[model samples]
Target: MSPANPFTRRKDRIDELAATAASPSGGIAEAGAVDEKPGVSLIASAWSRLKRSPVFLLGAGITLVFVVLALVSPLIAPHDPAAGLLLDQVRPQSNPVPGPQDGFPLGADSRGRDLLSRLLVGSQQTLIVGVFATITGLAGGLSLGILAGAFGGWVDALVMRVVDVMLSIPSLLLAFSIAAVAARPSQVTVIIAVAAVQVPVFARLLRGSMLAQRSSDHVVAARALGVTERAIVFRHMLPNSLAPVIVQSTLVLAVSIIDAAALSFLGLGNPNDRQPEWGQMLGRAQTYIYDYPHLAIYPALCIIVVALGFTLMGESLREALDPKSRR
Candidate 1:
């Protein structure tokens, strides 16, 4: 190799010396240290964390599958859920079983309706009940919570007292009571019953979250700046306060599913056999449970899986939101 230029050789030596001099004093380096990054919005950060989590991935997959199933059920399901294609092939199985017939994949229910079709169609019903009920609860809770949080004193006391009264009783019992009093049991009755049980929970959660944020620096700064009360509450407080509510809403969906199913199981849900709902299917299967446990198993499995999916996603979100948990 040609001899290095004198100036270039000197510069390289100097650079090496500088790096050596600047090295950390101790043998141990700050191995775990990371540069502090600019802060991200709560939602963006949560989403980033969620994307990295296996639990979130699994829950999202399951949720997506169910959502897809619900949307295209009519197009994909082989047979009408209300009408069974093969009654002769329908027989009680000690173990969960499918049919020999090409058209009937999951076999028929106690009424000879295709079990697969029912399960597929049933997803739509369960999703509707779980989602709409949560929405109902969220609405009631947001209204009450905002009033209590934004305007304290008697308004807070009054809303909280009512919430406490409802909270004292078991949620399921309260739902049953509501269903009994609200005319006859039907689809509408089931939704309202489930929604009623969830209202207090949402209301209490929002109130506490809002209260904690009420005295926050940002809120105080907004007040000092003479921002309108309406703007402060709606824009600043509500947005920040809603993260917990959104997470709670996911969890509430799981509860709503169970409650709707429980009501149907108790014969307080839609009584029409023509309508294929998981809980109602479970209710019907109760009579033949001993002879054919499969009848109950299929519907119960679907319910459990769906609820588990929502629960995992919600818990992942909760952890994402919590700084302590994130660490």
Candidate 2:
């Protein structure tokens, strides 16, 4: 056979090598194909991180328990929450069963109402007020923070100054003042007060997060690509900054519950005397402290336990969300 040209022979050998490299058994080629689906791999990596986080598991557990409690209280309560059984007034306390005078397992209040039932019902009110207030505060604060950070001039100064003013005053005093000034201590007024007090805290947190995010490479790239200011601020920066905000919001819910109870204890919430609020129950129980301590004790304990649960969840969420804590 005639000898192939030198260049052509070299080309044939290269082609053979290329074909071999394209085969499935080629380790480098197989690895390159595997790298194509990065999104799926990224999600799996995130799930792995979540699974490793003890704080995340604990927070999720606490949140689930409370959600179940709120949903099943009606079915779980042993007695009618609104019914007053006079025969069950001031019964002796027992763990397993209600005494003859006990309206329910938790004993009766001064009004002969079931303490257990009232607590079950009161949980709904606490959750409603806390959740709505936190949502309102988050929305308002996030808006202000985004505007301040994105604009970074007069707008920033104005928003920060307002936050400073709010923070200067004691939060409880501010809530109390707002509640007292309202025409009536309706649930709406209580919600508004709680949200108002929370706004400054949320604003500060978001503003700080936004300041850090504004300098990030992705944000800079988005800006360079001519993304609209609003879109860059909201769609791009907001989502990335939400981890800390979510953690803060969890703590804020617990704080809101405590604030609402304080407002009610000061006679600035749930206008009706018969309304079964934990704080209001405590207030009423004061009159029967000597004769029936269980009235106050039961409600107080319920508040303590519920607050403790939320506090633990908040701490867990904070630790889970914090990068430093993870490290």
Candidate 3:
């Protein structure tokens, strides 16, 4: 029999090549489809875990409520926080007042400013200061901590020594000292003072977390694979180290808010009397504690509620984030 024609042989070879390509392409698509399942499962598992944590839920709810209150204060508050109506000021709680004009619900301050309105407005200032200060502290401290932990020797010694010195001083005294030197206490000054005091705590916590994470098997494996030092530290170690940082940050927020209030109480916060900051109000109310107890009580209560909310959130976050607790 005659041998197959060369042209026919070439056609057959091309067909085989096309078939091989099509098969592998289909296999790749199938593999991708299979991989999507695990990705979706991971997200669902995380959601389920979060849903099961009652503490987390409670903390989230409280935080959301305060955030809403702050946002809607202008619309919901009955009277202007800074506006004083002297004729209607400090009406006694026992007075048979029935309307907003009589200041029935939230008693008027000595200055006749609505206590509820001031509290609502003050919440905005408090939340803003606390959040900004916490962010500043987190950014500064995390960078320093990661640098010290990832690169040992002189860098670590220098960073830790600075932290040690800061930690040795009482935070309140340090904040007061800085505030005193400031031209006048304002929101920016309060934020700076609070962040300055918080930086050391965050730096120490983050350093410990980073040190532990750096020694883990995954990090060591990444190092052995010739990954860049920056990549390993930032992309690999940073994510793992965040668990402790997140827990610590919530606690720091509580401390920062208290410190800010203390600063205001000490007459070292925003000098603008019209701003109606909780701490400043407390400072002003102290003089009238006997005659107008509501003045002191309202501002003091605001501080307590905000501080308690932050503390609760911190504690709940700590418990929820703990691996041991999960087990």
TM-score winner among the candidates?
A: 1
Per-residue lDDT for 180-242 in model 2, tens only? 899878888999999999998888888888889999999999999999988998898888887
**Candidate 1 on 190-218: residue-level lDDT in tens?**
88989988898999989998899889999
For model 1, state the Cα shift of residue 195 in Å.
0.6
Candidate 2, which segments miss by more than 4 Å at Cα? 1-59, 87-103
- Reference-based TM-score of each model: 0.85, 0.79, 0.79
Pairs of colliding residues, candidate 2: 88-101
Which candidate leads in lDDT? 1
Q: Looking at model 3, which ten-residue stretch has the lowest summed lDDT?
A: 95-104
Residue-by-residue lDDT tens digits, candidate 3, 1-327: 999999999999988866765785664445555434434453355456667767667766777888898888778888788887544534556432212446536766666667788888888888888899999989889888998888978999999999999999999999888888898778899999989998888898888888898889999999999999999989988888887788888888878888998999898889887787788888887866775577778778777776777677777666556756554
lDDT of each: 0.87, 0.77, 0.80
RMSD (CA, Å), candidate 2 to true, equals 6.3
How good is model 1 by TM-score? 0.85
Question: Looking at candidate 2, what is the lDDT of residue 216?
Answer: 98
Candidate 3 Cα deviation (angstroms), residue 120: 0.9
